[model samples]
Target chain A: MTLTDESPPMVNQAPSVPATQTVTLTVNGTAVELQLAPWTSLLDALREYMQLTGTKKGCDHGQCGACTVLVNGKRINSCLTLAIMQEGNSITTIEGLAQPEGLLPIQQAFIDHDAFQCGYCTPGQICSAVGLMNEGHAKTTDDIRELMSGNICRCGAYTNIVDAIQAVMHPQPDKL
Target chain B: MINFDYTRADGVTSAVRDRASELTAKFIAGGTNLIDLMKENVERPTRLIDINRLPLATITETEGGGLRLGALMTNADTAYDKQVSKRYPLLSQAILAGASAQLRNMATDGGNLMQRTRCYYFYDVATPCNKREPGSGCSAINGFNRIHAILGTEAGTPDRSIHCIATHPSDMCVALAALEAVVRVTGPDGDRTIPFAEFHRLPGNTPHIDNTLKDDELITAIDLPANGFSKNYAYLKLRDRTSYAFALVSVAAALEMEDGRITDARIALGG
Candidate 1:
């Protein structure tokens, strides 16, 4: 019932020196190498090591999805994952959701629907929305609510956020 | 937070070997629990051995007509897996009902089993929590103990001591208990298997102790037997909120009925 990753022991002793581990991962189509501590989270590594600050850190704990990212095409809370675990994996962040010239459909829809305010949780919200739209697990509002409940918006933008995602998923002819 | 050293382990063998020699070493996989504990200074490990890169992420079939779930399989993967959904629906539904989509995607099968309780007293260093500091006085016995355990209590134990009776916090484990899963552990000595019932120990008198895992031991995999009766199982979770919240009371039930007569029943509860 309990799910766990198969990682070796990383935290039973005190080390005399800081251990640096090398990791190679593809983020948003860019290959990057990072020298990180074994315990450094993917969120911390992305924000500190790679300097991709679009992924926000809300609860540090797994309760908030402000640090949501895509690993091997699956959405996950980056805060809960260690950077070392993502080696050789493909990662997609908020930065990867669009091209250099314009926004992705989800991002554009959020803009068109005015889906945010203060925007602290926007990056994570958009990322989670993208994952949900592509998940094929959600077919109704109930499913969407269940799937997107992890990403919380303090601005109370749930209505607009859901509307934006729905528009992208079920596009109207006039809107298109 | 204190500064600590870190090591990236290539596989489980090297990680366990390292832990056998280093007393301060601990395994770091999904940081869902370990990182939070470290940041709170509840668990201070100087050296963290990274085992996330090991080849243990797949869920495969065991030789004994059972399912072997790799230690690194994430909660989301297991919950949505076709095999798990068909054979062990309770396990799948329980995993989905507990954490949010994002957390489930990152939380691993092993880390979910190893998660500590969310006792407020245990987290508050200012208060006396035996689970946080063994032998320390308990403060929740007469305090806010509505969430404390009612089934397992030791006689002659002080009211304050009973504060540590918080039940196992994971919904996934509740289903595992009902499914009668087996945990496979790899240690310096060798590999060993423990039934799920014995895997998670009740607080009893020593509420501070969670499980029976040794210092250098690592959970390598979890194997679930083919219980034909489990096909008719279901997981029911009741929580304060509709989503992204822990369970208030959850039930994993497997019922076998012969023409409306209760032939067999397996049930596990978590609150």
Candidate 2:
């Protein structure tokens, strides 16, 4: 279960030289092109190259979900994936979570439910929640908690986060 | 990070040839681990051959009523695949039990098998880790070893002293070992197959060498035998937390029972 990325990066004293790659991504509804180093992760590409800092970089090692983004309709750790590797993939960050007209239901739900505090991890949590709802895996509150374990909120807003997600999962929960 | 050349592989044959022929050339599939290592200055690859466009991401059936998992198949897709869920449920359960949804979506099957140990000393360059540096003394030996491996261990001289007891940190590979899968590879010498159980070598005198994959070899696919451990299979993951954490120790067990008696069983442990 050692739930690390495919490979845990070991320490090294090897010599390294910078190399760059051009990537074309349809981000949030817009197509963005950037030239970045092969080692530049998707998190960095979005945050630095594209100037979309909504995606936070918590661990930069895939341990934290603060850099979560939707790539082709599925959530993934942006920090663990290289920018060049994601070329041609449509990426959706927290800033793009809303519609052209207004905020997304999940975004509004977070505010309505007060699902965050300090709000540093809010972007990742919101993006992850959108992906979680689309995957349609979480059925119960506990299931939501387990499935959303990747996104950590230091504010201890677990109950409210679950409530917000549950409201979207089963809208009738409020009516009941 | 060191400057390197990047080439998108046109096909499987060319990908293997390019990687095998060139030194310090690695096939970048998901980039989940490769990029991470690059940032830590661990793996200094001079050329990153992109193989994501290759047609090696499919999950199909083999001719012998078995399943063929493509090397580029992401962990999430394989875990949620209808066939994997029905046939090799142990693998599905094991994968789901490991990384989170975001990581699973990006981690590929080939990368999963190629995972390195999570030993703290191995990841901290300031420390002396024989795995990272062959001659570097192992700090974990005298340091904290709560997560050290308890199974298969050996000691060697300081120059090659491989007394590193770091355990494999892959839940998927643990299931693969128990299920007896075959790793298909294409190398400079052409194609070859390796038994799953023998994929990961025990931490012997060479703790640095994680698996049997050669420098130039490229993993093409993983062939899983016909549904053998479907029912009565359980993936038990134990760690500091209930989820989003590596297993301190985990078990993948598939049992076959007749009436009230046990007929056959396969179990593998992971940490």
Which candidate comes out best when scored by DockQ?
2
Q: For model 2, how does the per-residue alpha-carbon lDDT over B177-230 read when each residue is reduced to its tens digit?
A: 888899999888889999998888765566677888887888989999886588
Best by lDDT: 2
Write down the lDDT of every candidate, Cα atoms only: 0.80, 0.82
Per-residue C-alpha lDDT of model 2 across residues A65-120, encoded as one tens digit per residue: 88999998899889987777776788999888777888877788889999998898
DockQ of 2: 0.40
Provide the lowest-lDDT 10-residue window in model 1 chain A. A1-10
lDDT of model 2 at residue B17? 83
Model 2, runs deviating above 4 Å: A1-21, A172-176, B153-162
